[model samples]
Target: MKRLYRALLWLFPPGYRLAFGDEMTAVFEALARDRRRRGKAVYLEFLLTESITLIAGAVLEWIEKAAGREYPADVAAARRAETDVSVPAEIIEARQRVTTLVSLMTDAISRYDYKRARFYSLAEERERRRLRALETGQA
Candidate 1:
């Protein structure tokens, strides 16, 4: 069950994953805890639905990125791996899950995810160069 969650999260681009992995897991854990207080049936349903939705939403964003000329491989795998499951019925269900997860993901992407990744990568490179400079003590 947790593997499903992990598989779904694999859709996030590495940088986005690094930024939001813990936060998303926390949210999932809290949701699971609340459901446990309710019932096993509900908890199971929540797990299945959330896993599907979160993964589907990540797939959508991966498509969006690919369209924008960014090849997000990890994200892409989450989508392509299940190509045969693209029938209309499954798609409709996936779409519903995607709707909820997409809302949160979109919000995160806009708020901090994408920008932070880009900034982090740049800053990391700068730091590495600085370290090298310190070692060399010359341009």
Candidate 2:
């Protein structure tokens, strides 16, 4: 079932999959794990529902991409927040630093390098705090 779920993820467009595939898979796995604890019938039901929804979502995403539609505001914000030109130079630099740390943390976790992941995680937290301070004119 897990294998099937992973395979279905390929229905999404390559760019969409690249941006969100791991997160979607991790969420589905966690939900599957939780549903499995409820019993076989419930788990099966969850699997069917999730699979159908995922396929539909993938199709819709592909259609949107093919049509060249704008991204939803939240997604656009997330993508744009890193490079928003209207923000101060210091804020943009801080955001870039945080983005780099987050990328490093993700890479470390993927490699099972927990020590480096932990270091990056801590750095991210500190940077986030600093960013908040900057936003509030406290830095």
Candidate 3:
């Protein structure tokens, strides 16, 4: 099942996959683990539902790409927020830094690299504080 899921993830655009493939794989594994505890029937149902969703999502992503859209809609929303004219550049940079840190932390956690994850967690906290300060005009 996991193999199939990973294969399906390859259907996404290369850049999108590079950014989100590991995270999505981690989430799928976690969900599968939890559902397995609920019994075979529930787990099988989850697999069917998730597989359908994955295929549909990949198709939509491809369509969006073909239409000249860059990034998923959710990611475009985040980029829009980041680019708000009212927001200071420093704040935007800090927010982006924090986001990157969080992604690194999650990737580390997914790989069971606790030490690396903890390092990223601490860095993310610092960036979060910097972002807050920038937002409040204190930095």
Candidate 4:
């Protein structure tokens, strides 16, 4: 059951899984065990419900990711900073670009496209370095 649960987790977006997979798995395991204590019927019901919900959640998350509706931690912080009138638009735009590159890398990895993933990884790193250099007045 745990193995099946782990396999089903692959349906989730890579970033979402990276952020919450272990914790979600742990919680699922605990709930499964507790439900089993009631009866086979109860346990089966719990498993079915959980599995369906997980699949639905994964679909929604993928939609959000594809639509650019989700943001990474750093990007979200940068977006929040945009609310400040003093923050430069260029910085916010750069942060958003980095976030997009990261999302592309994760998507590539999820699809088992290592070459594309490597390219995006390098691109993201270069962008981050450029941002840092700009901050330090070296670029």
Candidate 5:
């Protein structure tokens, strides 16, 4: 059960998992142990409810992150500055373009639209090259 819970934790975004994985796991384990003392049925119900909630929460977190709303604007800006305070605007834009292209390509592939996927793949390659150039100060 602990292993399965750990696997579910992987569904969360990396930053979120890094920030709270151990604490969340510890709490879950303690709750599981307490629930088990009641009965198998009760423990199972708790597990089912928590598992579903975790999955839904992970999806919401990903959506929020993609929408650039995971953190409050001021905090988000501070985090970005801490990570890449010296990164130039052009480089950042280029990187974002590359990331967008990759996401589009993945969506196309998941929908089984090979042609659209190919187009996105080509665009992603071009964007990646642009990003590389910008990073190297050649653009």
Candidate 6:
């Protein structure tokens, strides 16, 4: 029941789970309870939907991991493909940033706590400023 749902959640990307994991589980539990009141089939429908989302959410991580993997290049064609077909490093960095935000937002969204993201963002900005001030010896 709930255990199975919890286990299925592990299929989601790590970034996603880092942010929204527990909140989503709580949500699923609530939904499951509601569905149980309705019928087991209704609960099953919810479970299926969750499984699909978990798999889909994992795709972003998989893509990034695949892109980062170093492939064997014994074949000349492999080397050419590696050199010729690729995303720019900037795009890869941007993707990494987006993954971070996605994880943060997911956590905030699941917690029903928008302020966590906002506060963290502001804190980061403040810390950057403070570091700059420190570097300049300006307190």
Candidate 6 structure quality by residue, lDDT tens digits, 34-127: 8878887887787788778767766554454334532232133323423543644443343344445545655665577978868655654455
Superposition TM-score, candidate 2 onto the true structure: 0.49
lDDT score of residue 14 within candidate 6: 38
Clashing pairs in 1: none
Segments in model 2 whose C-alpha atoms lie over 4 Å from true places: 70-139
Which residue pairs come into collision in candidate 4? none
The positional error of residue 49 in candidate 5, measured at the CA in angstroms, is 0.7
Per-prediction TM-score to the true structure, in the order listed: 0.44, 0.49, 0.50, 0.52, 0.54, 0.40
Q: Lowest summed-lDDT stretch of 10 residues in model 5?
A: 73-82
lDDT of predicted model 5: 0.74
lDDT of 1: 0.57
Q: Which scores better on TM-score, 2 or 3?
A: 3
lDDT (10s digit) by residue, model 3, range 11-64: 564445656788899999999999999999999999999989988987676556
Off by over 4 Å in 3: 72-139
Model 4 regions more than 4 Å off: 71-139
Clash-forming residue pairs, model 2: none
lDDT of 4 at 127: 84
Query: What does each candidate score in C-alpha RMSD?
Result: 19.0, 11.8, 12.1, 10.4, 9.0, 15.7
lDDT for model 2, please. Answer: 0.75
After superposition of all CA atoms, the RMSD between model 6 and the true structure is 15.7
**Superposed Cα deviation of residue 34, candidate 2 (Å):** 0.5
Model 5: per-residue lDDT, tens digit, 1-139?
8889887875665456656678899999999999999999999899999999999998776666565665454345535643685888777676566656756766777689999989987987787678667866887
Which of candidates 2 and 3 reaches a greater lDDT?
3
Candidate 3 least-lDDT 10 residues = 10-19
